[model samples]
Target: MNASTTQAYEPESHADQNSKNIIESIIHGLDTFRKFSRLYAFMGHVAGSFFSSLLAVDNLSQLNPTFFNGYLQYIVPHFFMHLYVVGLNQLADLEIDKINKPYLPLASGEFSLTNGIIIVASFLFLSFGAAWMIGSIPSFWGLLASFVLMTAYSVNLPFLRWKKSTILTVMSHVIGMTMSFNIAAFMHMKTFVLKNATSYPRSLFLVTVVMPIFYAVVATAKDLPDIEGDKAAGIKTLAVRLGSKKVFWFCVSLLQIAYGAAILIGASSPILWSKLFTVSAHALMALILWNRANSTDLSSNISLQSFYMFIFKVRVAIK
Candidate 1:
């Protein structure tokens, strides 16, 4: 009787264990989805599309259904490119991420390194393939430039890990952001069959100059919260080299200069309404950034991170 009772209990316990294992696997799958691709960052690409759309249309009246369709077509490839770049970075920085961003899928063990590799590979194939399918030389070149920069930043080769050096890091970001903007802008221009390779517009030139400076600040500030992890990993980021306080002030000054320049441009715009709106918006953004920077508690990583996102918001406003 005792042996029979034990045998009956063992089967039930095994079944229960199998169910628990399945549930755990499901939970981890969900976490991987949440943390791996980082869907929130997709908004940057969407904003790029919006700016491109604005530049593509001659006026509000020209923004019809076709314009919207073109935006979708252009944005899809951009989105995959972002995923590929970001995913590769995440994969390459798995150790650093374990220190600086433990909640990330690969770092947290919610997703295996193999899983990350597969996802990034898929994104890369889709991004380049989609760009080719679009059959726009400008768009393809823009994506190619972005891909090269992103690869340089992530690949662990001599002088390739641009994230380790301050100057290289800044240069990489500047070039990357410029390429990202151009990718969408050029795609929009292509959709309308506009004259490609013509003289650059004043607005385009301004954006090209401004975005790099803005991205420089963001790139430096991003390292602030990860200084400890970066130092531990022997990655000499700007924050690690200059100290967080100096880097913070440096980012602030850069932002101030950017906003000042925007305000000046807005003031000089020939259109009266454009002048007022741009000037007012930039002024407000400057004040907000200054206030946030002052109130930011450097010791609180969350606070610093939030302020960084706020900077991104200000950037979008300028656009």
Candidate 2:
């Protein structure tokens, strides 16, 4: 080919290569976002937030495109905030995660410390910016509180690192995630989509009462399998302070109590179908939790991890 013809081909080839690079970069970015998040944890938050919001939605006719878009307006921000929460822990607990959760992007060596930091900061920006754009006081405060609490829970700063205390850790999750996922989502939907006066629904009351117990269990039970890492890191999680067996049973019993409370709460519902379904569903869940706890072999790390994941899964399946 002539020089001019070769030059023409060079531009096209360069263009194709540039397009490929752009596509690959985008694919990598998306994959990193996924890897940065824990699937069960993400689903649990998403399900809880969406369910709480729906509880506040009174009118059947309101479940329209506009209402869902409004839901997304808040949910997307919460999603980013969750990423920040989880990622910050991974960043602070890199060595601990390497011991307990080696497959995580940062722990696995697939990502650098810088990569983790950037991913975390990017999510923080997204979450904060989105909440600001939405201009909802409840959403803003909820996100801010979640960010602060989770940051304290994970970050290894002086006078911080709330994960070092069992009470602080449990309280952080009980208040932090519940406020971010349930209360914020509920208020946003009630005031934004429904455009109604703020009043507590029975559903809201049930979740508020039950979720604190559930999160307490989650905070403590999560340490059961990570006892070694937590111990090494000097994180005084319940499993580290209390023996695995004790902490394990403690979490199970706590969850059972929450379930029992839920059942009683359900029975008081004035809606007939809601009362029956809620009561029966919670009863079944309580049984299942007990059954699974009995079968799990706490001495085995693999078994404990599996059981731990099941507990997290249950939170997602809720409602």
Candidate 3:
């Protein structure tokens, strides 16, 4: 069964409900750990970004055997990047999360701070080790960059704070994604940038541009549901800083703008018919967001769930 479904069965009372609560809480804590880390988003984004760049390369050149072969080698670095981001994001957010996301594992008392330290240690070991195994110092540096930025945004780095500023909040996403895209491009330079411009198909550029824009929007969309807690905690996210009305308009406007840009870019390019699927997915999401954003307050769980679902849908579409 699903984690949430399993989580729902925890008893409210029992002879030893406190002990049982602790166990159930641990389960829920793990679930929260999985959910908020944006692990799925990170994986999907890396996969989409990498493959779209590859497809761009394929479309630009005659299909060569070497280009087609050994593509799986990329997955090692991709996994390393995703693992680092997911684990680090969760660990970094632990403090702000207590205020803005009280339902999270640590905030909800599902896991102790001591347990959290152990988890973070394990996550770092696996992440850095994977990066090192990929045989690129740059890849390991990228892993380090992920940890540093996550920490800067969520915990320390008062000098470069994004947790309490709307502009910085959105800018952090753009910067992070830009770094990911550039690092991925650097790692797979042969496929991402070797084609001559005169011979390069426009389809590749379309994918590169559209994918990152989609990622930025998905990241910002997450802020909508956190406004209440953010305000209470003095975390001036886009939602809290702009207030609900402006944030609503901002998200919708971004969705429409990105959708329009994607459609136009795709139509003008030579991307395959299958690639049009991402556009269709975004159109459906726009409709879903419009309907849900109108009917639900930002603080409602349904609103938060819808935001999460949209991120998942975007990931699937791009992949």
Candidate 4:
């Protein structure tokens, strides 16, 4: 071939290589987004928030705000809580993620701490802004506490870990449950007060707070799958402290007792039967979740992931 012909071939070759590189880069970027598990994190906050909200406020229609404030309340707190949960998981599972979830954006070098920090800041700003819109100091501060817990969990503080302090895990779950419940309750209250300010029932206040604690116990079962990861990471989850079987049975008993309690509550109380039925449904769902929680067969590990996914699906379907 002549020199001119050779030159032409070289440019074509370079062009082909560049095209391939660009295509690969695009594919990898999309894959990294999936690994970040953003949707799953959002679903966690949504689930916790939805159930708690259901318990607190009976009517969903009363949340209308005059400005963007209404939409902000509905969206911002959950956004912050969800992102915070994702960041904390990535931070805590730093080692375990290296093994099991290396494809995660941070673990795989597809994303950076700077990127994570930016995302978290955006969430916090949106959350705080939403809380401000709600016009309730206590509830707004509840969201602020949610942000604080998220920060505590994401950063390695002096005394907080799976090994060093069960208080972290305990308080984290309790606070999360309250955040969700309170949002729901606050919305419901506005609805009730708007419709019949004079006749607003008082019992709802008690039920909203109590119900999330019970459901929170059921959500604790997810800690079981993380047992090995938790142990390796030197983290102390409820499963680690309670024993896998113990955690399973304890959740099961909690579900059963909650169900029975609802039946009894309905039989003797003047409160809404729907409230009892709602708790009953959650307890039944927990019982169903317990079946997978008790799986000792070891061969069904993949199935267990599916089971949890199903739980998530059902929770989302409820609201």
Write one digit per residue (lDDT tens) for candidate 4, span 146-237: 65665565566574443235555556756655555454434533442233332324444444444554545535766666677667777677
The per-residue C-alpha lDDT of model 1 at residue 269 equals 88
Q: lDDT per model, in order?
A: 0.78, 0.86, 0.58, 0.57
Candidate 3 — which pairs collide? Answer: none
CA RMSD, predictions in order: 4.5, 3.9, 8.7, 5.5
Error of 3 at 219 (Å): 3.3
Give lDDT for model 1. 0.78
Best by lDDT: 2
- Residue pairs with backbone overlap in model 4: 53-184, 56-185, 57-188, 162-235, 162-236
lDDT by residue for model 2 (119-189), tens: 88999999999989888778888899899899998888898899888888888889987898799888888
Prediction-by-prediction clash tally:
0, 0, 0, 5
Q: Candidate 1 lDDT, tens digit per residue, 1-319?
A: 9999999899999999999999999997886776777665667556754785566555666567766766666677878888888889988899999998999878888778888899899988998898788766666666787799879988899868888778888888777777767544654564544433444455665676666778888778888888878998999987898888888989999998998888888788899998999789889988988988999998877887887777777777778
> Which ten-residue region of model 2 has the weakest summed lDDT?
310-319
Please provide, for model 3 over 1-319, each residue's C-alpha lDDT reduced to its tens digit, 9 standing for 90 to 100.
Answer: 6987656665544537798889998987668767645566666655664664464453545446544432333445545456555555556666656766676666666767777667666667766776566454444555566566655666545586566665565566666664555444334434323433323445556555655566566666677766665666666666666666676666666666766676666555455674567567657766765775577565565666576566556545543
TM-score for each prediction? Answer: 0.87, 0.89, 0.69, 0.68
Candidate ordering by lDDT (highest first):
2, 1, 3, 4
Tell me how candidate 2 scores on lDDT. 0.86
